[model samples]
Target chain A: MSARRGKLWSRTVFLLILVTVAGVVLLPILYFLTISFASNYEAYQFPAKILPTFSYPARLRYNADTENYTLLLKKGADFEAVKTTSDASDFSLYCKSQLNVLISPPAVQTLFDRAKASDQAVPIKLRKDFFRNYVVFFILAEGTMRALFNSLKAAGWTILISLVLGGVTGYILARYKFRFSTTFSTSLLVVRMFPAVALSLPLVVYIMRMNLYDTPFALAIVYSVPNIALTAWITSSIFKGISVELEEAAMVFGATRLKTLRTITLPLAFPAIVASSLYAFLAAWNDSITALIMTNDNPTLALLVYRTVGSSTIPNLPAAGAVVLLIPSLVFTFIIKNYINQLWGKVAL
Target chain B: MSYLKLSSLKKTYPNGVTAVKDIDLEIEKGEFVVLLGPSGCGKTTTLRMLAGLEEVTEGSIVLDGKDITHLPPRQRDISMIFQSYAVWPHMTVAENIAYPLKLRKMDKRAIASKVEEVAKICKIVDYLDRYPAQLSGGQRQRVAVARALAVNSKLSLMDEPLSNLDAKLRVSVRTFLKEIHRNTGATTIFVTHDQAEAMALADRIVVMNEGRVEQVGSTREIYNECGSLFTAQFMGTPPANIQKVALASSRGRLVAAAGGGEGAMPLDLGDRSAFPGMEGLIGNEVFLAVRPENIAIGEPDGVNEASIEIVEPQGAYTILVTRVLGGEWKIMLEGDVDFRIGQKVSLKIDPGKVMFYDAQSTKRISLS
Candidate 1:
């Protein structure tokens, strides 16, 4: 092939591969976001809709023989049909359930009277509440907001422990060649693969004995065990890529080894540190299994969201909680996305 | 004692690999010394020991009358420029240059002025606020040099700092480094594998081999009067040609004869002054080393005659390659001297320039 044609063909292939990978990754998040935005009526609708409707489409059916009209509106499960005479003033009930539209007695009377005069069923649209599910999850749910705070607190503490402890371990593993370094590093990874349930079940006894069960701090302690190991492995690879000469250069210029680390080595490895912290944050923010076994009175938002999957029949509220659980992780991951680009390359010293 | 003295210095890793053998070097104040060798020759390891980056397994390093062998790099009062040009990417050029001063608890104003002075000297004044990533490779190297010069440390160590640059840029940067050395006069120890760079920049070159220092002398001495077979083979570009020969009788006279069996040729011994205690050992084997430039070429009337195989023009000089004792002997002629291919040529090696090494030990046999 000609050079130009070959280049064009390769570029086209690259673009196709890129678009396919993006779709595979983003399609689930898009569906979850749509589900979170749905109302109770939309959530239970069969053959689920990919988009949410802010208003309900309904019609007032008038039976001329009976002089009665039936207002068919979608409520919790599906479309519910209500039949009544023209004098009935229960139109507000349908307004609140379907439209979340508020109307006074006289205004509701006007709506029914207009339907009574028309022999044909009046085609009327009801405006539904846009953010009711979100409001219910964040403002109305009893422990959801508190659980969100608990998740944040746990993630924050996890990041702190991981960065401090894991950072030191990684630096030593990268720079020093002490005896048992290999065995120690390998064991750190092997410990991560142990079942969290088995460990947490046994550890919860100690946790409750210390009067620390059902606290976010207790859950954070459990979450940090695996995450710190992962952080160490990641940061150690990155720290190894950073040249030891940079640290020596600083030390040769009148800075102590500790000062050199603080000034030169740490800053050069900042991208890796940021990426590792994001991993720790997500581990603590999205964990449910550990939170399930470790906490009761003060469960994390993720645990609460997981519980709603079994308790709530409708998925709207639970999906809304899941959305909330996802926001912090998504935001933190996006902020460090550029830093994670350094994951594949040798981190420049 | 010299300003900087390394006595019985050695480095043996915990894994039992000796990177630097016992080394004793005394460098005077303001001397620019170079450690020149091929890879794995312990040149870089010695510089690292001097910079306190590597631990000395034994002995001591004395600088300015103070023993600093066990001292940390920060307490040793030294500065180093690395081969990788390790400019801190997080800091701006100005901050990188001023960090040492800040570590010493210098006031802000003095640090700024000192940074400005070194930046101006290194010609990086305009790049003070830009980070290292914003600069080119050569600019980053200047930043490294500027940071090293900013501190005014007692000694400066450089490990192949210019090797990363392009050939054209390396030459210019080499001049710039030399200029900085002359202006600062910091006792400097530079390590490089390139012999040309050592000859161009060093006051004295310490050639190393297999974790041992082969010789230490002025560049002229290293090139013209090599002390060992290794130095002779290492210092020259089209390296000196070597062949095994023995003093034997041809017509009741002593002459150096090629040890090669086929059509063995008798060559002149040049002078007997170089032979002090070898009267009885005339028939034993000896190694002859001759620099390309020292071989005079014209007519087929000298001590050894050989057929010219190829002539290479090197702009300033032309090199003639010939087979001597079944080996390629290169003869360098000044300025476009043409020698036709496949022609017989007689080459005379200057008696004073010719070097003889013990055939077994490979150490130079100096005339007593």
Candidate 2:
């Protein structure tokens, strides 16, 4: 009984911790998503709502003595009265201007007629468009689609270069013993500590000199400078954990050094490679400072979204662009998360 | 000429530690030789040198009349089974076995057939489609063997291949390895710290100690006539008893006297007829070595006597750890013996099996 009580107490504590952590991680994202879906009016509203609401409350009241109807729409705090209608035909333009809601004159006429016949106030509702912000960001916004493609092309190239170059360095560092192997591996990490932005600032001159300044490929090269070092560190530790005997077994079984690496070593280190590629992808996908300095005409989607912070008064379109940018990163991160689980979870050796 | 020769083969690491020091050996074609040693004795290092995995500091490895000491492993045309099995986890059993055959640029149909043939021999045919992660440890071991067998290389080297398996699986795999070797007749060099494994698998056993070869001989020779004090103490289940003893003549016959702390007593071990020229050295201090199995329990007839310190009954044989010669001496009795601690018993040593070593050098003092 005491053990069960203790277990229950611990479980409660663990659940508390879990809920707190999830809340901390998810609240900001939820708010951002809410903003991305917000209408232009709601985006300007102070202290935003957590969920996007589609409809506004309305009421039509009848004065029994005068036999006239009054239409009132709920805005922020108070009920706003539209123009008094003796004839029901005048509700269309007044409804359009006051609520931003389009109603046909015939429907407004019918609503007013019902309110005039009724002794009590009649309740009505107005519906708004839910996907207007998304449409505005993706389709209406100029060059957003092109910027998205630029982000993709840059991320793809970064993954390619980082894996090819860094994987080789990692394999060499893990397998070989030389006079300066320790020094060389430590230097790879030391290079990682230098900021990518600082590197990109100087590299842009070279990119322009090579006439590759506004291309995604040039941006990728700058991003890969830091990404390659990180990929090397991750892959080298993973490769070191895989026994050298596996490689030697391949070599002794009629495989050349290159063949051994291709068949035995690389395949065993695939999880780490995927994980490192995800790092490279994220570095290119999320980087704005490097993208800002590195390109002008070929702006990545992240930079375009970052540029919106200064240019746009409302946050909805920019938040919508950020939501669009988050999808590919989220997908790659999920894959990388799974790969990391597989990396250390099982004993391949 | 021998099929493989290592002349003055040496290995000195960059940090200045010598792993295999001055190893000189020649192995015949189709011979199964075992490098037997304790940990850090450099048996695996010597084997790795042959496989072209480790570089030789000095000397040459000539295989089938061609020097291959400096060649890469793939060019050396050798196959090695690692202690960890080292079967590729990413590849299917068939793919792991077929990789080497494929690298030879063999046709797909031919490679498949070769893979199937080796898989059947290793008894991993049903598991051909499964990855190594799906196989059991012993099955993985067979897959490793099958992978090596697919190559049909000039030489096959194994580095403590059975050390990872459980006792029952180890024995079974040991037999499997021996059977494979017999069927293929591949010139093989196997490394293990296990003396029993060496005796079971080796055509010749090379006993190593402290980076040097102590002795290389057949199982029978290694057991009966250990060439050095190291081998004598190293190559037994309950290792051979070695003690400092003073040999002197008493009443015109040679006798052995214990020279150590505690249980010090003189022993009359009969005449020195087995050691033909040892009469002149009667007063000499020497090393006396005896196999635990060779000492027998006897009535007190005044040879060497000791009180039983402990009795360990291991079903087939009861091991009697006794206090004798100023130290604990192990004696093996064949069956259930009624004995107690602190009970005095006489011990008769087998004259033929009695091995003597030089007092200073610790080398076997060959009197005959």
Candidate 3:
């Protein structure tokens, strides 16, 4: 009975830890999503909302003694007078700027006349266009779509270059023994020790000399420098796990060396290769400092999103941009998740 | 001309260690030859050289009248079954069998038919669409065999393929492999450390020690007529009993005396005429090897007397262990004969089957 109670206690503690970890990771993402859908006015509201709402309940009243119209917004159960305006254009501009609720001057004037006629307080429902922030970010922000394309191209080239060069180096390291092989493998890790930001500065000179500056290809070259080492380190262990006899079997059964590599070694190492490609993709897609130093006219989406954070006082626009930047990484990870599962399953065997 | 010939083949690693030293062999067409030795005895190295997986450091390999000493494995037109089976995990069983045929540029229809044929032979037809990961180890081994068979290459090489299976599975697979070889008639070179496996499967066994071949002959010849002390100690379940003793004539009968001085006892080895040319080496020390089955236990003969120390019943036969020449010696008797420990018995060794070896060189000495 004591053992059973102890097990139950441990299970409860484990569940608590799991929930805490999930909240810590997911709450920030949830907040970011809500802010991306928020209006400029909702962005500054105190005690921020966890979820976005489509419509706000409020009342419009005419104050005959003050000779002005008053807007009362519902906060919880009570209403509070938020703004007062007599001019139609002023009311229209206030709704558009503060409320993110579009109202034409003529429409505001009609509402004002109706409120003036009715001595009682008039109920009004203010509706907001939910996806306005996202639409405006793409349509109004210059070079945003181009930045998305640049990030994609850079990541693609990085995957291709890193897989081709690192995979061969990894296979050679795993399969062969030579003088100073340990030293050579250790030296690859040494290359990864230098910060990518430090290397990007010197690489820009070569990029300019080669006339490839401000291009996604130049960004790929810088990203691949560190990613190649990481890919080699990851793939070498996986290649070692694959038996050499498998490759030799292919060769003995009429396959040439290159054919053996293509058929046997690469397929066996594919899950690791896909995993390394994900590392390479994230390195190129999420890197902003390197892009800041290496690129000027052609910026990656991550760089654009970073610039958006500094320029905007309201967080909604930049949050929308960040959400846009998150999409490709999520899709890439989702697609290769099955392959990673296979890697784990194979290891268990 | 032989179907395959390796002339003075040698292998020396870059680390200054020689794995194979001056191996010369000729193989006839359709012969199943087994290279048998313990681990690190260069048997696998010799097989790898034949498969072109290892570079021949010194000599030439002529296959079907063509010099292929430096050629790569693919150019050699051979198929090998690895000890690990080495079946591709990603491919289905059918694809694994069809890959080599496809590489040889066979048409799709022919490849499919060939795959079905070999899969039927290997008893893996029911698992044609299943991947290797889904198959058991024994089934994967069959897939590997089927893959090698589908190629129908000039030569087939197996490197300890049965060592990975369980004991019972190993015996069944051994019979299955022998049956396949009989039906296929492909010239095969099999490498293994199991003496029984080699004896069971080989048309001829090449027994190796260290880096060179000790002897190469049929199973019966290797067992009954060992050319070297290594082969005699190597090719049996219980192994031959060998002892160093001095040869002397006792009353005109050849006798081997063990345990020098007054404590020495003479093992009467029948008439002097049985071993010709025995007079020259009188009183000289030589190694005497006697098979356990050849040593008969009987009433006290007043010549070679010993007390039984232990008895082991193996269902089919019984082994009696006794002290002889200051060492434990085993004797085999049929049908679990009642022999109790500490029982006094006399041992009579068969004179015609007795073998003598030169103590210095460890080589067999022919007396007839």
Docking class of 1: acceptable
Give the clashing pairs for model 1: none
Looking at candidate 3, what is the lDDT of residue A272? 86
lDDT (Cα, tens digit) per residue for candidate 2, span A1-349: 9999999999999999999999999999999998887766566667888887777688888877786778776667877675677765566665543334567888887887778777777898766656666666666557988999999999999999999999988987887788899888889888778887779888888999999999999999998988888888889998998898888888888888888877778777888898899889998999999888888888999998898766778788788888888988998788678766562214444
For candidate 3, lDDT tens digit of each residue in A107-211? 888888889999988998788878878777886568888999999999999999999888888888998898899899889988888998889998999999999
Compared with the true structure, what per-residue lDDT tens digits does model 2 show for residues B128-186? 98878888999999999998888898999999999999999999999999999999999
How does each model score on lDDT? 0.83, 0.86, 0.89
Instruction: Answer with 1 or 2, whichever has the higher lDDT.
Output: 2
Q: Write the per-residue lDDT of candidate 3 for residues B46-130, one digit (tens) a residue.
A: 9898888888899999999999999999999999999999998878899999999989999999999999999999999999998
Note the clash tally of each candidate.
Answer: 0, 0, 0
Which stretches of model 1 miss by more than 4 angstroms? A1-31, A46-48, A57-69, A73-110, A113-125, A138-140, A177-187, A338-349, B248-254, B259-263, B271-285, B359-361
- Which stretches of candidate 2 lie above 4 Å from their native place? A1-20, A45-47, A53-129, A138-141, A177-197, A203-212, A335-338, A342-349, B258-263
RMSD (CA, Å), candidate 2 to true, equals: 4.3
State the lDDT at B57 in candidate 1: 98
TM-score of each prediction? 0.89, 0.87, 0.96
In candidate 2, residue B129 scores what lDDT?
87
Flag regions of model 3 displaced more than 4 Å.
Answer: A1-11, A343-349, B259-264
